[model samples]
Target: MHPIAKSVPLRLLVLLSMLLAGCLAESEPVEVAGKCGPRDLTPECCLKQNPGQWEQCTGSTEMVETAKTAHSVATRVVAAGVTATVALQPRINSAEHRGAELAVDLLLRVDKAIAQCVRRAEREVNDYHFDGRSPSRELCQQLKVGEQTTWAAYLGLFKHEQAWPCLRKALDELLPKKNYLLHPRFRHDGQTGKWEFLDEQAVKKIVSEQGWKGLTGSIEPDIVILDEKGFIVHVYDLKFPCPETNVATWTRYKNETWKDWSQGDLYKTALGVTPKLVSPREGVVPETK
Candidate 1:
């Protein structure tokens, strides 16, 4: 290789190392809940559950992500404390403009603020990116990512109206892991109808009163599958925040909305349950304008 070419690869390696080992982070309150992604498997957790995930975790995206999740739970020494959620207020000229693209791509550093957020230890959310140029519903587009849809994020809380299905997926994904459930936090839309997770005070109440079963909400727990007799059996949906409400609040997104997190059960009925998950036939491409 030419001298310059040899140095080019070395320089690239050094820059990549910095991104993995030295990026600065700040905590915020908008963290979502139960954010177990493909990268959530910890070294021990990974090896214990399925070694393939850990051994194969070689890419930059996978390694950086796993270490981060493990750090959050590992950081909290005391069993109980004020719960925190990491939030990101992305400057979304249009949050739904992008089809299924992720939040990690931004040409500008300032835009980084809008990309990824390591929120409440319960859930990690990657904000959706639609358009930085404008916000118009004519630009109203479907924001999806496999099982998880990318609705325009409600700052500081889960997009409950759009978060239930994903939460169900989170529960299914993490169910086999014991520690993942021990000191769990519920992630859902908040009192303000935005992304948010369960507060510490509320979690203590669950343990003191309902125990893990209470982790399942008021809903009788039913799968959203459309197969004959339903695919899975029951699902006591998850709603973050507490259980109380103002009568008027019930009208905004219908009683089903997580507008008031204090309610006993937020999953009485699936809003968009049409037998099959109503997804587009084709993958979407978000417009940048």
Candidate 2:
């Protein structure tokens, strides 16, 4: 090789090394679930900090792998456009796999939460020997004094109370793992019957500072799954029907903006994805028109 040509590769290697070093130096320690580790350590640094203890590291392995993959793509970009695309193939595939895994995990968590809440409700009713009557006062001293006289009366309350919080608990745990948004906030446009997603912090700040308000009250979706590009891929709502046997259905909005529009219709129109109903008894069911 010519002297200059040989030196080019050596210089490129040094530049790449310097860039990698700079990245490592700039890496901030990742905090997960209130646990913090040594500052300025990447996942790779964590692995090196404690050999074979990567599982215990605070830095996410997924993040480090993505960073490495991105670096590979950057390096290959100078070689050939096709080479860069080829290098990015794995990352694309990985993202798809991650999304699939997230979907399954999310559904499983929802199912578990539903089962647990339903089981508790059932146990409470059985223990109290509920007579399925609307109680004004405690029928027996055994029954705790409440607005609802019998434990059976409380089942209706359970349907509402357990649905959000139970799913919230499950979804919150999964939020840090993937691109799942719990109770994603959106601004509603009544004139067009469209929803403008409020995901950007800057937009939210602008809204708050400017006192910007939606034409209609905001639509809070139960769960939203975003793709690698941050486009919403799926939407889900938890529905716990009081009877468990009764089919879950979306309620029509009585508000002036939504008028008679069913929630399912609004969600579909706004999100471009069919909203799914997850019930304790039914598992997963498609919204019926």
Candidate 3:
């Protein structure tokens, strides 16, 4: 009886330990939920069910595969825009073809510009999902700057008959909400310097709602971006663009044999233009600050 009493506590303690272990084994691991609006990322359930990502995932194969058709059109528009810029650069000074050149060049530039702008806009829209806000002015300005740079080389190069139409088409494709039903999609990758890919569904919606505005192709986008605190920024003054060199320069030590310069000869010419931003006050032109 004495032994039995003493053993009771020890046995009970062991039994309690076993019970606690069993309880822990039966319990599920915790999962903190993440969301994309009403949609949920639903932890391991979603991760396992979705395959890779909807873009590469196996379960939602149709959604991932839907984008294949749009790639060609996107690439073509980008290529055409770049070609127009290079061709227009030297022709700006030609007298015989001046009018036609400028007109064609400007239209092409506008086309490319708007295309870039739309692509950027689409990217911004995609990011909106993650950012929990519409595209910020900061993002727009950076995007606008890149778009503007890509087409400004031909802004005044020639008069383009199709310029206005191209610009309008480009703007129409963006700005307006297509579905307005689905949460606006968005993503951003600083490494790729590209916003997010516009899903096929979204792209199709835009096209069905607004027809294509293929480039000739190049564009000129007006940019007026303010900093986080609402102050305007001077991207030009803030950045020193590395000048393009078509030739190389050489230097020699007093008594040493001269080594071939890989950077080809180039010379510093007079400061052609010191670009400054001016707030627009007189109609279309901005006053220098």
Candidate 4:
């Protein structure tokens, strides 16, 4: 009936309309898939999911090549909304780009360093104390505990005395003093699991010589990587399992501002980076999808 439709064969017009409909459906609104990899963020999805916060969509890429393409019809399209992907072959010539590269390199090294420290700690603790041998009958008797009980107590102390020091020393050697934060404390906002770092004085004020009574307890990450601007770019937590074969997992807070939340989820939301878990046996567990 239409003039354009009359110009073409009826079957052809119907096929053309069907094709147009399919093309239109492709650009229709969509929700973010929430399937982006841990370290990978799709700009369009981020804009869709977090309406006003566009900054989260950038910075993962060392260098960005702006593609002047059509305006993104919706935020959910991966290639639309905004576009930045890790340059397949990035040239690290600029100082700004260098800092990002270094941060990534340091993180990779830290993963290896943590695994080494934990393994060494286990070996050193066993070698120094009993040469990997169980406590003698006489020693257990002297301690007034059964051998199994004595061993369990020793394993508990092993983490504090051996693993803690070993990990701290290794990190000190690997990370530049100004670039990495060790055991940095954060205060949580009551409404959200989001955390903001506490300055040295603020930390001291809350945790006096007496106790941390009445105040919400702090969340401390084993290590936090700070970029040149001092923004926390990455987080890591050392998990030393006594048995060496146990699965490494994120800690879950039970009370206060961070109640009912897992540490990994909180860190990701607050820092905008997926926290890594390091253990002697697990090395660095792959990031969960």
Candidate 5:
């Protein structure tokens, strides 16, 4: 190798070593803005002092905040869009025009908020350093929740109205993972009336031909799991700020509220399986008999 080329590699190695040393030096304990007792450390301060606990605390906090912000922004955007669309109906006679107007209004209102949430979420995910790259799993999952929340809000607004079937396209975008009951499969046994898997194309065809009769209506679950026979194996209803801790609150969710809404029973009647409730905090509840 040429003399200059050999010297260049050595110089680069020394620079890299210096950069690593600087990072290590910067990791030393330092004061942060938050209040800290004489012997205590705030989470920010502890990041340098005790990185292990800091990782756990900060990771959990970030996840919780990311989920909350995503849900809140999604709810707000959808609600505003629905209200605006309703108000614009008299101004725009065509359904297409009203929907376009709603989309534009929502984009203007929430584009910045969504971008901020996405950036924060991406940063948190980058902190994990999985394989030296930020994993998309967490970010995508959060975004999916946001998408589902938006769709649910639209469903609520359009339910029992003429625009329902048009909005049902949102559900089609949220098909569950493969091997899960909700994912569309291609096989069915006609004789035993058991399906090896639910056919996505067939279901779409039915919806197109017959309307939203057997598929979905005003009352719907967050996720619908279908059996091989195209019957519902399980329905998942996601609840925000889950009612897990408070006994009285949980009682209302189980007895008075859900019972009156009959969402579970409605799914059962339509797809032959009772729905299960899910939450970010509590996860899936045990299936009720």
Candidate 6:
């Protein structure tokens, strides 16, 4: 009928058109093969059906509603300037006030760090799914130095005994699988002045003392590995992101920041072992000599 159609074979033109249609279809968001109902609204089904709205489909309705309500309330509060404060406060302040302000800043940083790690993990899971592999707990074992350091910073902000479990999980996820036993919140007995491996009683006994609290509460190491005989073999300090500086500057910074009772020095001193500093970006484990 047409000049181009006449010039080309009809069968070949039809085949090319079909191939183009197939490519277009493949580029589009894949739709679920079957109908999705409430009872069978699994993540896989929801993702296939809605693409990006899987959360709305798969998340609990009650929990979603609750979250929406809380978000609305938070938005109003933020808008009303109820929690807003000027940053032009007096430079000179009481020691307690300064400490509290520093703690708040650290808490905010920790929250950001945790959020970044969670997002990265979610992306990794998505990639694994795209590669036709099911997400596994092994995904947790792929934490980089930055993630581990952020996790450690987050753990250091909390003083409660219950937070130790979280520390344990973080350590379990980040540490190398070297068959060594891990003690997340390892502490020494104040009475006998002896190191206790995986002992909560020892932690409780020393948590109350002012000196012990000062030593362990705000700056405890993330993990300590012990041999079969319950002796400390390696101490790890998960530090904040260090700036890219010359060797001398970096060395000075480390020396000043990781002085006595800071970093994992307290743990190392108590256990009579040198502590290793783990880089948050590269995951380098260099012993602090």
- Using lDDT, give the best candidate's number: 4
lDDT of 6 by residue, 71-184 (tens): 233322112111112222112112232211114554344334433443333233233323433333334234322222122211112111122334445534543232223223
RMSD of each: 20.4, 20.8, 25.7, 27.9, 23.4, 23.8
**C-alpha positional error of residue 134 in candidate 6 after TM-score superposition, expressed in Å:** 29
Residue 245 C-alpha lDDT in model 6: 20
lDDT, candidate 2, 1-289, per-residue tens:
3322222222222222222222211111101111213562543334334533424543445433543443443332121111111111111112234333246766566556645654454434333334433232333212221121223222433333334334446555655534555445566555875556554453435445643332134565566766555566667765545445566677676656567877788777767677877655566666766
Cα distance off (Å), candidate 6, residue 201: 5.2
Residue pairs in clash, model 2: none
Ranking by lDDT: 4, 2, 6, 5, 1, 3
Candidate 3's residue-wise lDDT over 1-289, tens digit each? 3322222222222212222222111111111122222242322223334422434322444434543432332322222211111111111111222121114554344335544433333233233323423333343223111122111111111112112233335534532311111111222234873333233453344445643221101111122122223221211111101111111112211211112311011000011111222111111211132
- C-alpha lDDT of all candidate models, in order: 0.25, 0.44, 0.23, 0.46, 0.30, 0.32
Alpha-carbon error at 240 in model 6, in Å? 3.0
In model 3, which range of ten residues has the least summed lDDT?
A: 262-271
Residues 1-289, candidate 5, lDDT per residue (tens digit)? 3322222222222212222222211111111122323344333333334433423434545433443443233322212112111111111112232111114453233223322332332233233223324333333223111122222222112111212222233323332222122112222244764323223444445445754332322232334433233334444544432112321112112222234434445444444454555433344554464
Point out the worst 10-residue segment of candidate 1 by lDDT.
242-251
Task: Report the CA-based lDDT of candidate 2 relative to the real structure.
Answer: 0.44
How many pairs of residues collide in each model? 26, 0, 26, 0, 3, 2
lDDT of 1 by residue, 1-289 (tens): 3322222222222222212221101111112223334564423223323423433433345444544453333222111222232231111112333122212432122112111111121132222322222223332233322212222212112222223334334534433211111122333333654323344556456556854334332222112211122122122222222111111111112123234432222322222111111111111111111
Worst 10 residues of 6 by lDDT: 23-32
**Candidate 4: pairs in clash:** none
